[model samples]
Target: MELRTRVVLQLAMATGAAASTLQMRWTTDAGACSSNGGQCNSLGPDGPWQAVMVTAGLENADSNSAAEVVDMPMWPAVGSISGVLTTSSGGEYNPFMSVSANKTGVRHDAFGPWLANLFINMTDEGPGYQEILRFKTSTDNSDELNATIVAAETWDIRMPTGAKYEAPAGFLGLGPSTAEDNKSIPPGLLDQLKAAGTITSNSFGLHMGSVALGQKGSLILGGYEQNRALGDVGVFELVNEVTRAFIVDLTLSVETGSSPFNQTGSMWKGVEGSEYGPDVTKNIGGVSGSAAILPSAVTPYIYLPPGNCEAVAEQLPVTFRQDLGLYTWNTEDPAYARIVNSPAYMGFVLADRTAQNITIKIPFKLLNLTLESPLVAEPTPYFPCKSVDSAYGVWQLGRAFLQGAFLGFNFEKSVMYMAQAPGPDMDQGVTRTLEVDDEVILSNAADTFEKTWRSQWTVLGGDETGSGEGGAETPNGSAPPAVGNDGQNAPGNKIGEAESANGDGETEENLGQVQEQGSLSVGAIAGVVVGVVAVLGLVASGLLFWRRRRRQAAKEDVPEKEWEAESASGVHFPGLGIKYEMYAPRVTHEAPGVELRHEMDGTGIGRRSMRISQDMYANRI
Candidate 1:
């Protein structure tokens, strides 16, 4: 059956079925790892694959907690998925998110190819740690099921293909894995060099991302990656265009007719975290540290594996129509969002008019997302760093930056949000839509996007004068002076009265003074406090460990009374490395009611102070 025909039918049945019953234990260790496709050999001995392991299964998170086995191949591939989201006026809108994926869905008259989501079990077990990926899917033996792309649902059909042979026992629970196989391994070239030399570092980590299943089946979008040290993030404009074009094409196909979702693109950014300066960095949870952003010109590309695809990379199927939407940050500032001195509107200009001379989304529209995580930034020396107690509660809040912007994606939902941005020409502007074939976003929209970005900082970046000044330019090539409400001419081009204005070129007289102000933010201060606390706690915990190990080895006369009593109560902090023995207590204080300043020698568990001679065993911290 065709993918689309089956999707609609199965979607109806999907609502009535019970959640899958299954579970699997994800493990990591010194064992073999790989699955059927003869891919296991890579994880066997001396390989980077040994560091990560993954186990996924069909199970309900609400009920099952224990690992259970089930058939891995029973799940079938979805044929197609489709949907359309239009504005209240029935006008299609664009998605404002900064990232996108290749998509597939239903549109009989639609163009060349549609995107599809594929899945397969995978585990990367490098030297230090193992990682497991678990996801679920529903069973549907229909074609229209393909129209069900990712979104507006939770439960899904989990199916996996592409596996390495003879995977480790700990890697067993994986059911559905998504990724493409290289098929060929060059030689012992790289592996042999590492094995012959010493491996210097081992920083184990994980990647966090979001994925939505299509209303019917799913969509196949591609992903990308950069230098291994940093993962994948792409150009937002590029993906946005693809999505807009696809929506248009989809609508046309069902009505008039046009090309297919053949060649599409997407944008991405590495996970966000703490590393750079304020407003200069962003952080995504799960991934540690901050991801310094780069312009759209040269973003990375991810080739998806046939199975469960990596967020950085995705797999695209040629048979279905597909369009990849790119979402990204506006790298420009608002002061120059639009052009005020255009031949079109020469009269009085609007001050504080956010949108300047930005182009509208001719074929589509622009979009922006207001909700996002906190930006990453390192504390300046005076910034008073804080990591106080590990959980960093003070540093985290529900909202970070209020980045209200716009991008385009057609929708069926009635009411949707669009960011009102300032254009370069000082005119009101919305999101820019692009032609999928071209990577450039609409001119005015791009400028407006950049302008909004500048409002976040004091001055806009990449200002032409290099002085950080902002103003309108006449078509005849004359620069106009900025005016104040008093009708007096304001400083035309002077920027950053002193210091560089927050990476933007705008000049504020006391910028230097502001920079000199108290450098640390509340989050930084908290980090410092947390760091110190953790360090102290670790020291105390170590001391306790040393004392315990020594006592176990020496058979010192540890009064059973003191061990039991102290273990039960009396100042115990596991991480702080401090444990007080009822009998060997270092604390000397009089009991509340009795003036008994009873104190025990600093002796620990049956031994003298750790590493100290029997003579100098009195002090403890």
Candidate 2:
């Protein structure tokens, strides 16, 4: 059988342009920004950009719930701690008022005291809750030389009584705090951060990290990770003033052998030998309209137009579960393993109003997420493609799509920028602060797509010498590096870390390198060279090469049962423990009614009551 291929190449090649000559100049002295009660420079030679590390883990480490709680980025916050500890002589030793709550509420034993007064109310969507109190908060970025307190919305889940719990993960909201319909809402986190002079502008960027590779993602306020986004950046206007929705002419397609739904006579059709059987390699078509980028959504599903959802479902081994209102993956099918392990992907083409388009390729492995407990009776493999009626205005690209795409929003300018995100194995240290009016620069030399695909192909038993069919060769006439199934590079192919651009506009080498005898690797040196040559041209070839090498590499011959058991044992979905009601259509009818009057007294001032009764009488017309 002949299979077709739809390869979408990068729009622009990387150009050897000179790096930006601009240097970071701080107007104030060292440590002045943090010492003045969280007030710092906003518009100066040094931009007002602050970087926050977003790590992934469970909110309560001791909890036994299994809801696929994976790939959730917890933000940092500052908590107020009053009172002083008494010394042995009954004298106050060290007096402290507040503390930085960085990396708190992740484990069951380290609950932050600031969340004691916060109450969460769950919505119809599981895991997506609203805090009743608009608590005053500040980002715990003391290490970044800024810490400002402002009031914003915080989210968490209410646990059962007597259950041990920690402070829930902090979700930073970047949208407009007040909508036209609701003026009482508090300011968003970005706006609050700007007000406190913690950041330069009310803008932010997000890379949701890669679950397939177990990598931690980052949230940059007033800037973005230069190396995280590749190729051309598509800028779109925020169409919905309330939700910040944008218009994207989206098209979906898949590679050959990527999905079982593309097979002939798949389960999409109930009949045998039906004409609906088409070659699995055909284009799946497109859906054009507005799609909201919601990072706070509970599920990873990308809600799409109903017809487009059906088109994608036709190419995958998924069945529509009416109960869950989602398409569940058929883990029993042999093709399921092949699709995830193979070098196959689902391509998404997002075009702006200017007709500029960029294709985002999502590896099948990232889409192979599991749903447990409340979502399903047992651990079940599920697809993130969701179908919703277009009439309801429910088109949205949730965390599932954000995993492969980097989203940056500038509310002050009413613009949103999108670009293809680098894979988890790539280096992530190339961060550049953005000015209020600055635009995101797209790289012509960064081949993030080709590099990502080549790495995955090599891990799937392909030739490592770049002689395999349809593989892109590196500049050295060799494959990039062999990445294991667990998203770690093979030994000796590790990429080195690029020094972060610090104050005085000068780059700092490893500040605390304990190994004086060790030298930088070829890949690491190449990264620094590229960074100096072109600020945006830095490529993370093997920065985190052996980060996860300790994980047992998955073998092709591994039994399917064994893989299933391993996956089901620890995987969970964030915010799925709460109960929610699925939306369903309802019917209503109107009937004629008659009014009955009763009087208790004869006088006009006496009490009188009137009741309306519906007439059930029907006439044969």
Candidate 3:
């Protein structure tokens, strides 16, 4: 079998290049970026919210990129303090110097050989929840934070052993929650940061720039930028009525320029109870959704209801690529310009249930995206839009919608503030940190917001945009790490969750790892082989069963209304939990039956094999 490699095109924001310097390239190939693409800079001379070139995993203040630049989103987790602490002095916490794991396969590139010496030890305490702070190396001492905080909880952490390039750094999460047993575990990172005195306030500002416009957005820890906001900051109450995600009431409308849909309706508008065209007047809750989930870590895709999704597909001239499970535009079509460059806009409105509520408008530049992947040969333009099929519970407002607004979350106040984001050329902004002495912004914001609500939400218009899809430029194809329970926070953020090019089970994370020496006992080897075969067979049978079930449903002509009614009653959403492997090497046991050995194969890379049982002392409520 021939291994057909796909080109992971470097989209605009994903590369963090200046607009004039922007160009597509393979995900594994190195470009002419400085210091191997790590953001390196000092604290004093930097502009406000300026770009820093510090990559992940460097112990020293000033060090070049240790591994190729890849993007991975990571979060901080707080541990429970109610129980007596038991110290398991198994692995000493050093400065965490060097590249410990590269499970995502960037370790195979030109920089792979250099990664081994950078930092190669990862202490695997093994499954179940534990606190961990995976901080990246910064260029300076003062601005670079080094404080003792609770470790963030994670499931299935992939610490790939090989030097395969991944993000130089992971994202610092501001959310205060975690996913456990299909439910949200609270007191996330925000609580930890506050306890450690990392910030004076519980709020953090985010400005993920539009690479197409050469905008430089920055993450303001513990605060936000002043002048970069285009309007009054719209404060909203964070509701936990749905999933643990950030949810807001929103309506979606798409403008297809001078397309036929625009002939009768200027844009296809789907709101609660207003029928515009042939499409049914789905409620904004049905069209856009009741609780729109805003995830910063994953790529931006507008996951909508099936009715709204169909309305969008009908509005544009797109061919549905079944293999890729996405809609592609015909660039050669004369109507293409109307779809991509029309002065009109596609609007996503963030509004409240009341007649008078805060509204934030998202434009077309933020919606119509240009996507290219190693999975696809050329740059294919598509809307980062999808549907919940027949479901109607949680809608996701991804990176595309965020690009149009500056999002600030204050976990302390349980409120969210959003403002229209200013262009790069608009203003030089000042930074403000939340002080403990200061009053809660949400309280004051709510008092003021009561008088500001208008019956209708505003629609933002523009042509300036970001990349074709919802992701930040990361070295190892990782997305901007945000608070997520699912393992989809790594690279390939917006890419569909389908099989790879050869329809094989292998993916970017599972594809490559540098294997070193290892040996397994006869019993161990037999157990492993049997396990693999059993798993594969089970998976195949389960998939076949699912497909047959789906076929039967289609033949039965089940009314869409049935799912809608069921969804209205609330879907039993077991929190999304995907498994990812973390490969670790170099382990020695001082005692018998407490062995930590590397499971090695022909490739010589290593997988940590543990033969010890952990005593469960504390249980978090």
Candidate 4:
């Protein structure tokens, strides 16, 4: 059955429709612009181009919560801003701002001095209290790129009073304005900028820089950085406008010298030898029909069908942890170090709308990310792949995949563009501007940088000559320049550094060394009091349960089934059961002038209901 399904998918991809074109221009000779803050003149003659720095830092400069600040690296692409929230009662307070992952969910206070402002009744804007605030991207008073946006004044997660809320900081929502739930939502940052004629269209580009290289990323409004993307651009249409989903047919494969399995033959039954490598290569297979690219997801995972995820898991030394809903890497295994340090990569081939194929290769180093503190007892290496039930009819690629892929959205044209992004060391400061109605062409040339991992790094046990094992064959049988894990040249050969838009000759601080400190604020003191009260209540309840248990007979405890918590915005923990809510009739948030919809009639048979649920889930935002 699996073989038959694979054949059908291959046939469908071969006969797909022609790809779409985007209007844009690419240039590498323009003046360099500061990614931290300033006008990106490199974006060409486009007017009012703003560059927002993507840093792995705390959004609130005054936050002193040591336990939470350590998790900043997990949430990169945090755009920085300072803004004031004003209440209807003439109260005002400044709040820290960061990029929001929840497309339409409300922003809340996690750790900062903004807690007091969150409870104040702001001027109502329909479904919730909202206020308009002007924010500057940098501390520079002279920067004219400041933006005004509407923000939600309530918390998305309503925690019981006296319980320490683990909510995230204030967020800047960039979801599509055309979404059904967002119809009444005030215009987002992008929409407001377009309305004021600050930008030609409601379009943006993003490159979540490498966590391994400790590189800072860029979020460009109005255009993209041409240097970041390499090779040809794969254009995909927004299949579901409500979800802003970009779906594509994709295949996955991995190449490595050290095979995890003892068997020598290929694991995939009908996969062609030409499509993969020798016995060392593993064909991880592809999605049944299509997969969604969810760039805004809060978690960093690549959700795939159960069978496909297991296929990839078989190639690595990993074990699934039910508690965390993630695959924890076995660091004690020698193969773990060999696979991550050696020149191995898992490649993804996506079919564009034009029937053209573009491959994005992610090195093993990037896939070997770490989870620390609250997520786990200690820092643990983890594999980002998660299995989803086939019944849902939808799989997604999240932020982890974006580390090596550049995403560009053209809302006006209802088109999305993607390409392989270069590492920080390979950037050349090239940029492109996509103006309204301009014709943009994609290059058909080969990738400017090396795509094969073997061509860049040396394998540990490989031959010293670099020709036979763990190395790519070269004309002169010589090894390429070796690079350290930090993206710097090793002692043997030195590579030239490309000029960057930031113009900072120094390398960024490593993820482990990056830290921010601030004294406790009013919010922290209030949180301490709430925490003490909650602890006392828990202790008193525990004593009562202990006395009752002593009087009863001892009994074997049953193992609890694994479960995941779903948020109001529909973001679920990985590897959870299907959400039946997608099929149920539901009403929008209670507000003025919004009507309730009863779409599900409970009159269908079993199979018919299942089919309807799958269809509805696929279309859900």
Q: TM-scores of the models, in the given order?
A: 0.17, 0.45, 0.44, 0.49
lDDT-best of 1 and 2: 2
Off by over 4 Å in 1: 1-55, 58-65, 68-135, 138-621
Q: Which one wins by TM-score: 1 or 3?
A: 3
lDDT of 1 by residue, 179-223 (tens): 214222111111111233311111000111101100011110110
lDDT assessment of candidate 4: 0.40
State the displacement of the C-alpha of residue 439, model 2, in Å, after optimal TM-score superposition.
3.4
TM-score winner, 1 or 2: 2
Which tens-of-lDDT digit does each residue in 214-312 have in candidate 3? 455545546666544554455555543111232224433333212222212322223322112112112222224233344342223455433454455
Report lDDT per candidate.
0.20, 0.39, 0.35, 0.40
**Model 3 steric clash total:** 53
Which pairs of residues collide in candidate 4? 18-354, 19-353, 19-354, 23-440, 24-440
Candidate 2, residues 1-621, lDDT tens digits: the string is 111101111110121111211112121212213222332222101111122222111234435643211111223221211111112112111111112212212113112221212111111111111221121112222112211112112222222221222222223334554343644334555555566665677666666665346544555666666766878887766433222233343433333322222222211111111111111001111122334332232224565443445555555556666444456766654445545666556666665536576666776666776665434557677777754332112234655666777777667776777777776566535556566776554432346555654555423333322222445232112233344333344334424123334333444344225125357766776676565656433333233443333233433344557645654443432112111111111111101111000110111111121110001001100
lDDT of 2: 0.39
Q: Best candidate, lDDT-wise?
A: 4
Give each model's clash number. 191, 16, 53, 5
478: Cα error in model 1, Å? 12
Model 4 lDDT per residue over 1-621, tens place: 245434643543453211111111111101111221222221101001112321222234445532111110112221222222223212122122342211234443331111111111112221122333332221211112222222334333211121222222223334344433644455545566666664566666676655355444555555666766778888765543322232333333334344322222322222121111111111111233434333432334665434444455555666666444456777765556656665555566666656576777666667787765445557788877655432223334655677677777666676677788765466444445566553342432344545423344534443422233554322122223344343344334422221121213232321112223335556765664566457567767988998677555235342223221233323563112133222221111211111100100111112233343334334342
Task: Tell me the lDDT of candidate 1.
Answer: 0.20
